[model samples]
Target chain A: MRGTPRLVAALCTVVVALLLQVTVFPHLAWNGVVPDLVLLAVVGAALVTDARFATLLGFGAGLLLDVAPPADHAAGRWALALLVVGYVVGRVAHDHQPGGQRPSYPVMLAAGAAGAFVGTSLFALSGLVLRDPAVGVGELLEVVLAAVAYDVLAAVVVVPATVWLFTREPGPRPAQVTPRLPRRTPV
Target chain B: MSLDTRPPRQRPVRQVSTPRERLEASGMPSRSLLVALVLACVALMVVDLSGGKDSPIAPVRRVVGEVIGPAQAAVSEVMGPIVGLPGALRTNDALRDDLAVAKDRNADLEAELERAGYNDNRYDEFAGMCQMIGDLGYAVSPAHVIGYGSAQSFSDTVTIDAGSDAGLRPDMTVLNNDGLVGRVLAVTSETATVLLIIDPASTVGGRVGDNMENGMVDGQGGFEADRPLELRLLDNTVVPQKGQAVVTWGSEGGAPYVSGVPIGEVSKTFEELRLGTFRAVLEPYVDFTSLGLVGVVVPAGDDQRVIAADCVPGGTR
Candidate 1:
């Protein structure tokens, strides 16, 4: 995959993941915490794409989550958290395998868990600093644990699928020309 | 028959062509750019926090809501049943148990209604809102729950299909069939954001029982049947009893909440040694988890006569 196409695909994946995160995931919440699909998408993008692209993608996706309906927290909280997640995940994953080989499932899952923890903690800590009415010190621990667990479980399926989509080669095109048969008009 | 059909296998070769190419392919972002983006995020949060209701971020939030709100509503409508199947099945037995309890409550309400001589026409109205609306004479705009939960925060909120266009405004009280749901926090053209009362940050002024003892009700974060709202009576000497009905104490002009709306029933009572005041736990009537249709109380226009003017000795207005 080339640069522009990969960027477009990554953007679409993040948007779709965000939609699922806010809509479907809420219904499937475990212990009042929904899996951060957008974060997982960023981690997946980090594993396959360069650090720069993943970081920007993370910022944009996080901003969307922050501003999306039903969100009452300060804007940019997720953006800051996810930007860091993207940068760390992309740099670590890229450095770990200079050969550009696709990371194994365990490696990808570990990255997802790490990204989840980093993103969720950063967001929570900022909420605490801001004195966000919604963030209680006692509840913060439960939220962080549930968010990381759910993201890791979701990462098992989401990360590998994202990697395949981002890295898969285009299919061969059909032949555009036909061979000419010799003319037999003289006979 | 001589068409070339071999698979392209030069991808590896292209990747490893040169060290410079490998470095370029690695796609590591420059530290300066990361720092710049991080700084930008912090600035945004700062501006948003200090700006309050008129924050510059409100426009951005509104734009995002307008763009993505419909997609969320569509996904919620189409996928709600399918995704909720497992949960529905899990709660099926619990719902069966509730049926018996509901039957008993129904009997009690029916006898009360008989004694009160309530109108039959009011019974046809949807949910618990109709009864409250009838009793209180509140004008309410009905709306459907389109989405739930914030993507990254622990705030308990829901997006409803109605918005400013539907006469909804921030600070308006929202209720469902069962009881008080929450209050509208923000409104766009076609959708509104509601902050649920079950959120830890929420506090509502409540009046307990016929004595109408005033108290402050605080949410305990999450909504579980066992987790109830904590109520602290203003008068330290009076102790509220179990089974006492708690209702909203109505805000002035009713911007955030109206008076006489049933909030919950006192489940247990205990003395708070620290405050030396009697406190009680109230199990809210509305179930926050399975919210669907809800009503936003729209204050009646000045030109219209207040229907419940005589009900309260002093009018809410």
Candidate 2:
């Protein structure tokens, strides 16, 4: 956690995932479906790292996602969604795992599912409620499918690499138990 | 070495104090996460039910947004060349569908142009219209939008190339191929900013031909959102329906906006007990998103003269 190289890698990972979310992911729609790579990464981070680390990553990812094209909602919506997703995932994962060693594929996948649900639901609801933009059920379902698919795939490959990365040095200390006001919004 | 050998550095920064404290310290909500979620939801509902008025919360959101917008714009710019790659990778079937749609749209446009008799007046129309309109004592100046207005504001605004050098003035109405675009908001020698009527802050007097109940057209969507605007009937006696050609009543008013400028038609109308009026939203004639060549109405005779004084000291110039 203290190593500069690892910190940079995590930062780069978050950026790359967010870049994909904004630039490439939305464009890669199949029958009007696109992946939520940022959400996947947040869940992926929570699965391996502690709540503190996950929350930070979420803030960054959320910020990037907010700025992207098709960004048609309240600003903090994505950040808030990602932060909540990461925290909830990290806490629940810790609870289920108990020992809290490196995360396994199942744990990462579970975290991914939960994160996607929370992220997409909050994002859509913000648009529907706060903005009063009329959206249909079909569009929401499409986002859900995309998020789930992206999460499943990301968890398959990224979790192992993250586990190795964390195990290489040392993992985050432990879940912070209490949430922080967070200087920056977590991606 | 024991796994517990290392001592803590600076006591871990007290990262996550407690969920409640975290929520409270943020100055947003100090409660259980569930409570916070409920509060946010309730706030959202209140904002939504308030009938989509522009609120002060946008600047707060924009502050958060401004931090990341530039980076996203940069990435979008960088990815410009990479855009067409994915489209090219589409299957033949999808390509055929796209081709068919394009062809259909092309045919429809061609027919419309033919019907409008653009071929007959292609060369003479602008010059002739310019002369005809100028003889009527209206100074016409041309303008083009160079770029978008402020990104933080959801209202559609554009910066035009013509300004005071062309004798442009504030409140000068702007029009495009379709209809009224907006009125000039700010101006300089080289450029002038026009606030599109689609913005929530913009209010224009609208009355369809002889409807007698010339209602007020207010921007439907709030500041941070992009949605079709609404035109509510200020006078409750008349209810407006969809597809009604809503035009500016320049025929009646000597106002600079002109009476007959085509605003959007009635897109939505509803009666709510709270508002107690038939509120209808109009879809503007000019598609603000893709506006290009536009006309600026500079100060012209009676139109310009009436504003200062109806006296007309020396009579007709």
Candidate 3:
């Protein structure tokens, strides 16, 4: 029950992000590479959620990407890659201690960059393994670097906001204290 | 002994594990569950990679596509007008310049018409006849591009709003004003997917210029923004020269592409001495990066109007 609202919000975010990824991002592509907003969202989700949840989210997100139009590769390659990403990011997130604490900007940026690198690498590897490798190693490396840089930059803004929005539990209002009135001098 | 002044040193207590601790030790949120999901995904991948269109995943993919395709179409429809604004503005500027020239031409044409005493009705009829003759050979349906491939792996395709509802079918040739764009790959009730000629998997039988030398034009996966397509000649007797026009050698009755449609121009020619054949790199006529209004070439039936030979004076067939 507690996860319902967050899950809905996450789903909305995923839909919007996927839409933008297919539409507006193509216009903003640099060197034929657009930032993976969904991957960034997945990483953000992982930071705020448990490993199992992250894994599930990753599979769902990757599945959406796989089935989407213009998808040429085998289905589930992205799912596998992103599943690994979500689980690893979630596990790594546990290292920073006390749950529910918002990650700092630097930490979020690192996570985003690392997640993008890992996710893109795994995607490329999966492609090579499951399908024909249309791109070479050098190109693959370039794609990974571009994706990481772009994701890091995006994460700098998106991660903190997402963590605050989804992960942080509101603190209880400070216990209100009613101070005792000074004993009226026996009036 | 019963009332010892000093209390015995407290012994260290061994920690007892709680249910939660046990759950955490076994990997909370279910490690086995995650593993099962992963294995399922792997199995799906194996099935998908091993099978072609008939794979179980294809229908699932199609169903999922139908779910998202409409949303994408709506977004593209909204975005289309906005994306065109810049070009529209540029065109407006150009139109202003052309307007004065057009006015001058109009005045001249008016004077000529007065001198010639042109019959408006007869001229309209003649123009209609000419247009009818022009459309008799072929018919085209206009379509709007709804979306482009989101991932690099599938970068060579685009989705269009018009589909079987608009008479689109698989292998129908699509073209822009510039030249050949691609062929229809798949279609649903209201939408179709086109595999752009620039895709790596695409191969078009091409003929070079007036020499009519046959060759194959293949897409290079658009690896670099600079180079979009590649070409390889088949015959050794005649060599394809640089800057020669490349046109579709075409298919039977032009099912995939119409005969003699412009594909591209040769950019560079490479000689393979060992294979005794030449390869030509091409600069495609169509700028695939920015796609707009496209036309689907469909076969026109025998109901076309043919002009009478007697209509032309001093003209012989």
The number of the candidate with the highest DockQ is 1
Q: How big is the positional error of residue B54 in model 3, measured in Å on the Cα after superposition?
A: 1.1
lDDT, residue B289, model 3: 72
Per-model TM-score on C-alpha atoms: 0.50, 0.38, 0.48
What is every candidate's C-alpha DockQ against the true complex, given to 2 decimals? 0.45, 0.06, 0.27
Candidate 1 local lDDT, A61-164, one digit each (tens): 89888998879998999999999898888888777775456888888889899999999999999899888756677799788988899889999999888888
After superposition, the stretches of candidate 1 with alpha carbons farther than 4 Å from their true spots are: A171-187, B1-26, B83-317
lDDT of each: 0.82, 0.65, 0.75
lDDT score, candidate 1: 0.82
Residue-level lDDT tens digits of model 3 in A18-84: 8777767666677888788888888888887767777888888988888877576888888888898
Query: How much is the TM-score of the A chain of model 2?
Result: 0.75
Candidate 2 or 1, higher TM-score = 1
lDDT of each residue in B1-317, candidate 2, tens digit only? 55876676976775858776664443222235445554554554455345333644444446645655676677667666677676568898998999999999999998998767654543333443344334334445667788786767766678999888777778877776467777898889999998888777778778765464687777754334445566667677678877787776553333447656677787677886787888776767776766666767655543431212112212322
RMSD per prediction, one decimal? 30.7, 31.8, 30.2
User: Please, what are the lDDT tens digits per residue for candidate 1 over residues B277-299?
Assistant: 99899989887887776888886
Model 2 sits at an interface RMSD, in angstroms, of 7.0
| TM of chain B vs. native, candidate 2 | 0.50
Candidate 1 C-alpha error for residue B103, in Å: 4.9
**lDDT of each residue in B1-317, candidate 3, tens digit only:** 37778767686567688876765653335667678878977987888878877888888878867877787788778877876787666666689889989999999998988867445544443443334324334455657678988665666899988888777789988876567788999999899999888888889888886788888888876635566777787767676777889988888977887766678998887788898777778899887877766667765533222233122312211
Backbone clashes for every candidate come to 1, 21, 0
